[model samples]
Target: MSCLVSSTCSLVPFDSSLNRPSRSSKLGSSISWQSSFPRLSIEIGPVISSPIVKKESFVQAAWTRRSRGEAAKRPNKKSWKQRTDMYMRPFLLNVFFSRKFIHAKVMHRPTSKVISVATTNARDIRTNIPSLVDDEACRLIGKLIAERSKEADVYAVSYEPRKGERIEGKLGIVIDTIKEHGIIFVP
Candidate 1:
């Protein structure tokens, strides 16, 4: 019989045969307690040690098998939002000190352009307003917009030029507007 003290400690009935000193007649005091009782010296053989297997009670094993069977019966993939919410909702709630929620809005203008807005707060407006017409700013803003779109599902709509309209000129104007007002309407 054995009594487990904790996960790392256990007490087992000392085996008399193994505990018997090889040379009992030798009365040398140099030998330590380990040498006196060799059976008490644990010989952990090459065995795979797993916490699940170590502490698994009968009830736990039964419940685990039942859960596994139920999971096998219905296997489904989770959406990006659902997965994100499941992992990050608690963290976001703790950070924001409120319940977390996501709202998405897809707006279609009279022109062919389409604008999308997504945020937890309705008042938060993120416009892809270009800070500068320079190549560096354009690249940085492009990357930022792409990242924001993926995170919040907000797509910035760009206008399609008509026949004979200078695309570069319109782009310059848009950049100027963004630099001045920090936002510009699609089309």
Candidate 2:
């Protein structure tokens, strides 16, 4: 309950008179020892002890530091997801729209395997589709990918668009087409 309000404590300096020389001098030194150090009159009592916190082991210190750090910076999506089952993210539906073509991939997240893929540049799609990067092409690619996803035994999937990507235009059409084909999107 106390702050740092302590008194200064200094030990008495050594004196030659306190040393034992001869047997007769030793006897005289004990009687004169009382007067030898005048500064020894300073009152001595139990110290209040250190006001510092108790010591912590290395692991305890690390845990304390980690807890403080966690409060300062919250867990990001990746760290938050790690707390759940690793296999909880079964499949991921990622669509990439390039200048020349549109590519859709369904990946098995746990095993890092590609389950199904559909692209506008494929032989079947390229020959049938007039424009590879148009809304109709995106829809066809989405439907193809959905059918392929069903063949892979994945009924539901998750998708995260690129950073700062707005869900509209051709991109929106593709997503809608996939959902229209009965491939559920796990948000």
Candidate 3:
């Protein structure tokens, strides 16, 4: 019979009859030496060894996947924010576009607070811009947000497009306008 110490331990065989204790032969002792525990023998197995390597960060993994033509494997909005929060700057500039209006906000991620905001529905923008929603309106909103962000001391911003929105066309114009107004866009 054998006893297990750990999962990877090897089995060891022993002759049970030779190690059994006698009941009659006893010295004048208060406590008995014989006990119920079974005697066991162990044979150590060979040591196992394996190589270890450091794992890549989420952002690096994402870039690698992109380079491999696996665009669909990119992280979603929630995970992207969580990963970026670890290493990138704490300030984030978020832009949202809708059917009738475009909205932009500069947010401090660490404190979860908005630094500045601008939208087509604002009083000054509505009064100055003729159309509420269009390429021109998008540019105006971008410029307004950049100016306001500067007032709040935020010079750099990250653009987070929605699920399938491409960074071109009207969206491209908005981003260019923000950059022209002296705000940096984090890639």
Candidate 2 TM-score to native: 0.58
Name the lDDT of candidate 1.
0.36
Model 3 alpha-carbon miss at residue 158, Å: 1.1
| Off by more than 4 A, model 3 | 1-87
Could you give candidate 3's per-residue lDDT for residues 1-187 as a string of tens digits? 4434452332233334554322333544444433222233233445445322223212233322334244455545345667666358777777777888888888888788999888898887788878888989988888888888899888988877778989898778888999999998887
Model 2 pairs whose backbones collide: none
Over 4 Å off, model 2: 1-65, 69-78, 82-86
Q: Per-residue lDDT tens digits of candidate 1, residues 1-187?
A: 2333333332344334665224334646576554433233233335536333233223333432336667677678554676754333221100011233323222333332323333333333223423233443333333433444345443333334446756454244333433343332244
Q: Best by lDDT, which number?
A: 2
TM-score of each: 0.20, 0.58, 0.53
Worst 10 residues of 2 by lDDT: 51-60
Candidate 3 positional error at 98, Å:
1.8
**Top-scoring candidate (TM-score):** 2
What digit string (tens of lDDT, one per residue) describes model 2 on residues 90-110? 788888889999998999888
Off by over 4 Å in 1: 1-131, 154-158, 166-187
